[model samples]
Target chain A: MARVLIVEDEMLVAMLIEDVIVDLGHEVVGPAMRLETALEVVEAENVDFAILDINLAGKQSFPVADRLADLGVPFIFASGYGAAGLNERHRQAQVVQKPFAPDQIASLLERL
Target chain B: MILQNDTPNIDPFRFLGKDGEAAEIIRTYDWSSTPLGRVEEWPPCLRTSTALLLQSPVPIVMLWGEEGVMIYNDAYSVFAGSRHPALFGSNVREGWAEIVDFNDNVMKVGLAGGTLAYRDQELTLHRKGFPEQVWMDLDYSPVLDEEGKPAGVIAIVVETTERVLAERRNREEYERLQNLFSQAPTFMAMTSGPEHTFEMVNPEYQTLVGDRQVVGKTLVDAMPEIAKQGYLDLMDDVFKTGKTVRRAAERVMFARTKDAPLVERYVDFVYQPIRDERGAVVSIFTQGSDVTERVRAENHQKLLINELNHRVKNTLTSIQSIVTQTLRGVQTREEASKAITNRILALSRAHNVLTAENWDGAELRAMVVSSLEAFQVESREAIRINGPDLRVGPHAAMSIALALHELATNAAKYGALSFSDGSVDVSWQLLGDKFELDWIERDGPTVVPGDRKGFGSRLLLQVLPLELQGTATIDYRPDGVAFNFATSLEAVNDRPALEGV
Candidate 1:
């Protein structure tokens, strides 16, 4: 079982992603709802994998993703927006589209 | 008997006795003492009237006794003044020598015994009382003798300078209006009455309506569609309110010809109420300009912006694939970093081509050459590029560049270019709006990178579908790496590179 961090601003989408992760035999860490909070969680906790939304309420989760990368934690991005919304370096990360099926989320997590 | 200032009547002269009053007066007149000279007899009634005419207010003159000259009344003496004082009973030629020719012409008609009536015959006379020449319209009539011989001439005159000047000004005003109507560039038409029935249309108006038979027709009759679009209603409003209606950017579509496409136009127009002397609306004047091109340009710009958004998203996905695959194959950190940086540089070079072309599209040959330049340490013989000139869009160009770079790098490290006797062949062709290119490596080391699940493998298989809306296949043969891909030329050529799929 993997300990996964969820970083998303929208409460509804965050909850949906969290439900999918928990169903996938993964334990959910603090579903950090903001970029600052997500960054702090990444520094403080042990995360096996992270599922990030590119945009928080009004902030980018790029900083958290960068921190995860430094910590050697694998992550996938779930976004409604296209790849252009991400920074150049992070474009290679696995992306699961929004309103995605639970199985698609599991497969993306499996790939990571 | 006669009163001095009242009215007078008298038979004063009895030259031929009462039995022959006309003959007696003609024989007794002293013709030599006036402007007419050496006259023997006058016409019978003129002879008697000549003595009485000297007492009248209007100018009167008599030529008596065949002298063919003039006589004067009391008012005429004052008008004639000191000049030609022998005006009465004087010879026309000898007494008034300077004016004899004019007198002769008048007398000649009388001598033929014809009554000559000349009305408003302009004459300029410089008389004693008038220092400057005065204009006059003289009417001369001749009185004949019983024997049909010339006796005298009568003159009446009037002047006409002011009337002539007024007519000239009226003509000038009409010409000015005609000049304005013909030269105006805007569609202009004059309509009569509140119904705004077209009375006349300028050339521009005729061109706008695309019909020659617009005149004498109401707006509804000529172009019912215009009425349906509320143009006629607007005219009615202008007439009712006595106010002008000015509309800008008014959208309309006009049919130029029966078979032609409807031309969409935006227009600015004015409907001005023309009022009569009673301050009632008599007509409406309409003037308008077509502005279709400007509106179309604005719509095109908006479409371009939306397209750019999609292109940027697709571009990011491509970079992501490159990164993920490159990192996947690397066994060492340094090697992974180097591969990623090189791939990034390849992507950057494609972007530069897009930027230089303002994202419209990049040339296929140019993109190929740019990608191969990094790997090409030698001349053209080392790398054979064979293809017709073509262009590729940002998405396709970037993908193709990275793929080429991967192939070239592999060639340099282990295949053809790894030794001094190796070479590469690249060729492309256009199939409709899609471009197909092949990168074939030859004369290389034995082609032995056998089934290694590397970054290059994943890139060729996965990235093309997500980024280019195309397909890429890499054939691992015993001879060399043969790579092929196909994508839409339109996808690569559309402007602002962000626009296409």
Candidate 2:
């Protein structure tokens, strides 16, 4: 089972995604709710993979994505605006729009 | 008087050239009936001049002495239109009857040993059996007799009608283009050469640059800031490549006057290159419209749409969380369904409160009243809610609304509302930077504390304080359940949702 990290700001969304990740037979890392916290988790943990929300409160999570890329950890972005919201650097990365089904997350985890 | 028959043996008309129609016309004409009499009596100057003009290709006509009699060659016949053979020996005044006075001036000037010339002279003539307007370049010089005295006027006529009319049409077309350039709604400018000198600037273009006198000045000279913004480079690229450059909704900074502050504006523009006949770039034509207001409105709309999408997605996830946890806690499908509807309704009611405030912030009193609206109305009067006028940010307001719903739900089920005489007191205040709120139940059934770690208790004890970045507690008192919450005022009145994103 892969150790997946969740970086989402919405409290229930984070919890719901955490539940989904655990149900997919994977160990869960931080469901970091802020950019700084996500970056800290990426630096401190032996993360195998990550699911990043594009927005954190009023801030963007691109810096977290950058840190994850630097650590050679693969990740996908989850956002309400979908892939259109990603900047130039991360535009080609995988994206899963919010209000996602558990099965969508499960299939993505299997691919990871 | 000289006689033509006496000179017939000498062949007096021998000087007339053997080629052209004018030579035959002169030979067969009855010149003896005119004042100059016959060809044998003609002066040597007239004979020599007529012969010389007849062989020449230019249109030439000579008027002999006294009555100014007309003599011309083949070329002049075409210039005469249809008034040819009938005009051979006719007097100059009656030959071109429409311009009799104009020819009269020419006759008097030439016979007096003076010369006259007119370029593109406009005149009316009936050469075609009808009056027609024409233009000609006419030159008149006196032809002297053998005695070196003024004798007759020799004239050369060149019709300039076609050229004059073409020039007039060209001028009219140029004026029409000038009018369009001046009145166009879009700004337009022409800059020439590598210096990008502004050669032409219409009124709309003038207004775009705050009516600056930009004509004849290089773009860098008139607006150095624009050059710094890299528009000068763009123009140079277009000039060198002879290609067109288009930009849309691009930001530019401008100041109305030298002392004024720079204001940001957006524009949609094109730079088109003008080429010479050799296909070399010579000038850049710039045309565009100031689109600051349109761009700003579009940006605001995009922000609103994104904000709306984010909120909707988050609210759906909140409902998802409610449904999943509710189903896990309930004993039956009926109980789960009722609890899911109630939770979603609570969330929807909170959204209404936030929407009323445009999602900026909500009044604490409004949140309190709306959250308790679903409870038993007979018990609403018993629920005392007292708080100073306070505004909480959208996230804080939504969390507090849900937390209050949970507490009231518990009160209606087993606390204050379950007993008719029971009542609840809810109050909040701000002291310095810290905020404090209290919900105390009195005169209710004795509360039985249970280790119920359900969705409602989790929201009250965990999510509310975590979201608000503060502390919250619920005490199962023997009389009722009491809940107290405290956080910083800044956390309660946080920045509006969707700001800076």
Question: Which candidate should be chosen as best, given TM-score against the real structure?
Answer: 2
- lDDT per residue for candidate 1 within B1-501, as digits (tens), equals 134224334343443233332233345666446544333333455655565554445655555445665555555555555654544445666655656677677677766665555443434344554443333345566665566555566554344434444555777787777778868888888888767789878888777778647788887887776788888888888889999999887897776676677766787788888999999988988888766677667767764664455445434544555555556567899988888788778878877876788766678888888999887756557788989977655546656777788788888888877868678889988888887778887866567654444666545555443344467777766667787877666544523323432
Q: How far off is each candidate at the interface, as Cα RMSD in Å?
A: 14.0, 2.2
Cα lDDT of model 1 overall? 0.67
CAPRI quality level assigned to candidate 1 from its DockQ score: incorrect
lDDT of 2 by residue, B264-283 (tens): 88889999999999999999
Kindly give the number of clashing pairs for every candidate.
20, 0
Which candidate should be chosen as best, given DockQ against the real structure?
2
lDDT by candidate, in order shown: 0.67, 0.85
